[model samples]
Target: PRPTQQTQTFIPNTSGGNLPEITSELLNSYIHSSQWHFIKQLAPKITPSLITSALLDLHKNPDLAFQFINHLGFRRIRDIKTRCIAIAVISGLSTSKPTLQLLKETLNSGIATIQVVFNELAVARDELRIRSSTVFDFLLRVCCELKRDDDAFKCFYMMKEKGFVPKIESCNDMLSMFVKLNRPYKAWVLYAEMFRMRIKSSVCTFNIMINLLCKEGKLQKAKDFLGFMESLGIKPNIVTYNTIVHGYCLSGRIEGARLVLNAMKSRGVQPDSYTYGSFVSGMCKEGRLEEASRMLEQMKENGLVPTAVTYNTLIDGYCNKGNLEMAFSFRDEMVKQGIMPTASTYNLLIHELLMERKMVEADDMLKEMGEKGIVPDSITYNILINGYCRCGNAKKAFSLHDEMIHKGMLPDIVMFNALIDGHCTNGNIERAFSLLKEMDRMKVHPDEVTYNTLMHGRCRQGKVEEARRLLDQMKRRGIKPDHISFNPTRLTYNALIQGLCKNQEGDLAEELLREMVSKGITPDDNTYFSLIEGIASVDKAAESSNS
Candidate 1:
């Protein structure tokens, strides 16, 4: 069979301007054409499409096209569309190998750099007063579209310096780029410049600012901006409400989000999936699953389908609460509805199973995840290692830790702490110290929890002096050996005190009590009650049998 050659059809402009078919010969005829000769010859008859075709034909030798276009000038090409297309052709060629070669040649010349040449080209648009600004606008728009933001920024200020108003859309793109890069301050500077330039602010511009304010946790300011929007006669769209709602939800101001939701209704704007998703996510984070479920029902009533993310939130919340059955049930439900479970879904289930010490079940979940085409990541390995450590199977834990490293996953401090505490609990103090040495070699600084775990282990083994030394080491590390700083809660102190009392070390227990009081950690009723019982048990004081 003969191979069929693929061909493309050229479509002419709908307007009176027909796309000219310019061949090499047609373009070559203009090689010796004098300055203004081609412009005067093709006057009134030349269209943007024709000029574009001529430039494309001369793309190999871009200098001819550039020099010729420069000579023709914006005044001669009075059609704004013609001037834009003429520059558009050059912009398209700017990425080509031939064009880049020409650029390098042009830049290598000490007399003028590529930037200088472009600057000269950019300013030539000001030759005619009316078409001047539009020329730079065209150039700026092209620069932004090509992701030449640096050039776009320079051109923007150049327009301001030259009194030529750059394109408002280009300025907005620049602002959008800054916000996306998390340089909200830069966005603000550009926005202020827009104000100084008297450029009309679009709704998109205000929405970007509102989102930035929301991300910065300035909820009240974000909401106040809504009034500013309405005051300027710019009505709030669904996106505007959604951004504020999401912000409020993330800030744990679910109640405020409800107010925004009501405001959206009052303004005749319908809440979308994003609004409901944000509320559900916040509720799930607070372990308010029942309310999240109610919101889920509300979402369905509104005819919006919950995304996988929505289901993941519920699943994770249930998993954290030890409601594994419900978590798996939601996973099944999401699958039944054609929303396949993601790796996060399996991660939650596996972590909970590991926490419960159901190693067999966790292994089964790993296999299931593999069958479902979900790859286990670092979190999966960490959970498995912690699970083995909890089972006192240090060998298995070390094996999994090695596997994680082999798979390019670096062991973090959490993994090391788990191993260290595991060895300490098994009374393998030498092995624990070796792991600490390895941690130091890896440059993973031991956190307060790590030190606290070691201290509790030593205190359990009646090595009070060693445990006390660890506390001093913690202070030397610049980590204040405070009650809360040692561990996240008061449990560490209570456990240490109980262990000391059980070992007949009432004096140390009293010292800990005094230290707790001196540090201003108010002893709760349970803390005092535990301490009294510990002292009585340690002193072997017989209680009355009459009761």
Candidate 2:
């Protein structure tokens, strides 16, 4: 016999002598002997409260408890209360893989739906519903773990609909999942439903909602929710402070983030590395490198270990400031602290080195990175290709492109754009066109920049007619060309008109002049200068030939 406490207030049948108490010793003995039929026979008489009490006692005897939980897989049990208890215990078990697999097979067999199980719980009785909510909560987690999101969500909604209040922790898990899936709107809706149902929320619940608000870019709403938390007597933790701080930082509101840091300190909450990292990242983008460096030092002085992301942010700041020596020193400091540099760290360094036109040093650094087991991604290859293009080495750029392809990296639009722009700048219209064809075959849609470069290259090679057709093709593809694409500068108009006139296509030049006029741009003296001079020079050459 178990000494019963008054923990289960809604327990039935005891005061009225309707249900009899079954001894824990007898239950344990039956389970230990593997008397499955006898266990099933006694399951109906077990009240939900008795089930709850027995669970607390079962942990004392490991072997009996193991067999007891395994015996819960029986499908013939008719009592809703006992079935809920059995499934709940199985759901909460930390078992081996085989046990879990068997549990999964058993669970998927008899239950038509999670709601059907919930509906059978007799929730109108307060004590039974209170006892049953745990099982439903555990089942919801099981559904979530199995990636049965639709069923999990339905089960949760049913909890609210059936007048059964869900546990705060289970609600938080569901909310966290919605946020992870980037479906914050659904989380917000569920939270609203939770409020309407009078389900009590904990501090963690508030923090989860705050993070969702921040992630959705509702910064002001997030702050208002923080105020609401204080009003409701829910003291914000460091996680709450960190989430709002990061939100402000993401929006480039550096001053707002700094104010949050001050407020957190005044409230006696110590900011961790993550809190400082957000402010540092924001300051770096605003070009306030000195303050960002000072914050980094402050984080160290506070005895909080900075993350690799922290060092990477500072490194990027120095690199963008054209302070290569400082950036290298930070990289060294990171290594000394036993924080290995990530791919982002090297990418920023290599990009800046290439921009400074230090080709030999850049190549050596890339080779060194590879030797150190850092595989370069597509972004690294694109930067190197763009560097080669800028240095008028289209051949080297093409070789890098081929190497990236050999490494199984599908070239992105930026990669294709760099190569196309390189060939165009080299006046190799044929190669540029071939690359454009490759882009089409790869299903990478060309943006406005692609067509602008190709048109300019065609015009440079006296293929003004081809350039005009490419512009039309851009429109047919539903791409709205910028001024540089179709309505180019007066210089581009001059180049195209000069090329057409030089080719002895005087009629084509007149058509181009009329077309340029239709684009709402005023033709200046320079535009006519190329057209008039080219025609005059061509006529003079024709007269000389006749003589």
Candidate 3:
């Protein structure tokens, strides 16, 4: 709260009206007064020049200026000059929050670009004789928080060019934003820049860089980072160790993870749920379910409560191994342990149930989800939509599709492929084609699965020419069938060859074989069988024509 207004004698202006001349002293008096309504009454007389003068007058008392600006409201400070002056004044206060708030408001106000604000703030800073670069540092922090990484990067160098080094926290924020955006390369460049600038890094900075190294699959380098930190006399924290453990686990190097675990413990850094969870997940990935379960037991014995992620990892393992009994047992155990199942937990169970062709059970599980207040996410809807499609009930699949969209979930490529496959299976080639057009309108690029399904549909309808055109279109679009590693290119060639053979287009089928071989796609037994059938059909047609 501002101090009460001091009783001061005011001298009337010779050319002014009944109100006294509004000098900086009078403005300061009104600013410190508990009666802000008086200032509101004098709003008409307040101009940008008056605000700038008053800010300069109250430069030594930034708190009063901040309050005065707040009472003036951002709308009144619409001009870029006044706003920057206001930001510069408030920046002198001991707390950064008020200054940051004002700066953010100024930038978001659209009165000036970031560059303009940067320049104006510098001018205002110089006019006030404020030598500190705190205001510019706050600008970088705000830009980073707004996710304007490129703009922030430009501003960073700009500040540096002006002989100003932003505080280390601002630099870390920039690096962290790059990591969050998955632009590890940019993060590295910026990291090197920070090093060159001699900006000392914090533990948070090292942690973020370690995560980046792990993301790039440079696990060995990630481990070496701990040594680098130690050499610099910086102690490693729990997060640092957990990141490396997780990295090793992600690459299926369980032994490497074990070494890290032992090292962390020997250093008196105890393993938490996340640390143990990584091991469980890695073991599950390697099909060591029994070992993963035993690890879970050890985690519990250590008095570390397992997170939903831990339980979910175990459940997913069992689901993959087709052991629903064990999966459900873990789910029940988690609920009994007072850890409510997350949407992810339910999604896993529902996906496995659908994979087993048990639609009724999947539906029941979905109902249970609503009862338990577990809102279904996009993954949940995709699982249900796909299950219904596989069961040949396109109506239910489409109905679920509408529901998911209504719930504000955008259907991804996987869901679209399922819908297209469902339509093709039901002999609705025209509808499938329409969906393909919809994909284009929605800016969802159709992948090879999309073209493969469409080609197979056209072949089923005996529209061999359309299927062949689809193959050509696939080539034109540069859609690689094996872009998704699990989907082999052979499946694509097989679909086209079988379609041509069925339509008695043996010449086209043979041509496709040659093309497939030229692309280094070895023809499978199905490919040869389709070619032989095509040849036999062509021979029969020729004989019949001769007779």
- Which candidate leads the pack in TM-score? 3
Clashes of each: 0, 0, 0
TM-score of each: 0.65, 0.72, 0.85
Global Cα RMSD, each model: 12.9, 10.0, 6.1
TM-score of 2: 0.72
Error of 3 at 195 (Å): 4.6
Which segments of model 3 are wrong by more than 4 Å?
1-29, 41-44, 75-78, 110-116, 150-165, 183-199, 406-408, 472-493, 511-522, 541-547
Residues 1-547, candidate 2, lDDT per residue (tens digit)?
2235323322232233343456777765676677866655566555455555555455345345556645543344334444544444443345434333433443576545566665643332242223445556665666655666667688887876766677777778788888888887778887987898777888899999999998888988988998899999989999999999999998899888888888889989999989999988988888888998899899999998889898888889888888988988888999999888887888888888888888887888789788889889888898899888887778989999999989998888888888998988877778888988998788787777787778778877878888778767765666444322333545555666777776777777878788788877678887788778878988998999999
Cα lDDT tens digits, model 3, 1-547, are 1122322222212343355356556666777674577666666556566677778788998888887877767655667777888899899888999888877777676778888999988889888999899899999999987888888988898998999987889988998899889888889999998899999988888999999999899999998998898789888899999999999999999999999999999989999999999999999999999999999999999999999999999999999999999999999999999999999999999999989988889999999999988899999999899988988889999999989888888888999999999999998889999989988877778888898899889888888788878877777666454333222378888988998888788888889899889988999999999989888988999999999
lDDT of 1 by residue, 211-322 (tens): 9999899999999999998999999999999999999989888999999999999999999988999999999887789999899889989999999999999999899899
Candidate 3, which ten residues in sequence have the lowest lDDT sum? 1-10
Displacement of residue 528 (Cα, Å) in model 2 is 6.6
Report how far residue 414 has shifted in candidate 3, in Å: 2.0
User: Would you list the C-alpha lDDT of every candidate in the order shown?
Assistant: 0.72, 0.74, 0.86
Order by lDDT, highest first: 3, 2, 1
Judge candidate 3 against the unseen true structure and give its global Cα lDDT, from 0 to 1: 0.86
Stretches off by above 4 angstroms in model 2 are: 1-89, 92-131, 142-153, 181-184, 216-220, 426-428, 479-498, 501-547
In the predicted model 2, the residue pairs found to clash are none
| Model 1 Cα shift for residue 394 (angstroms) | 3.7
What is the lDDT for 319 in model 1?
Answer: 91
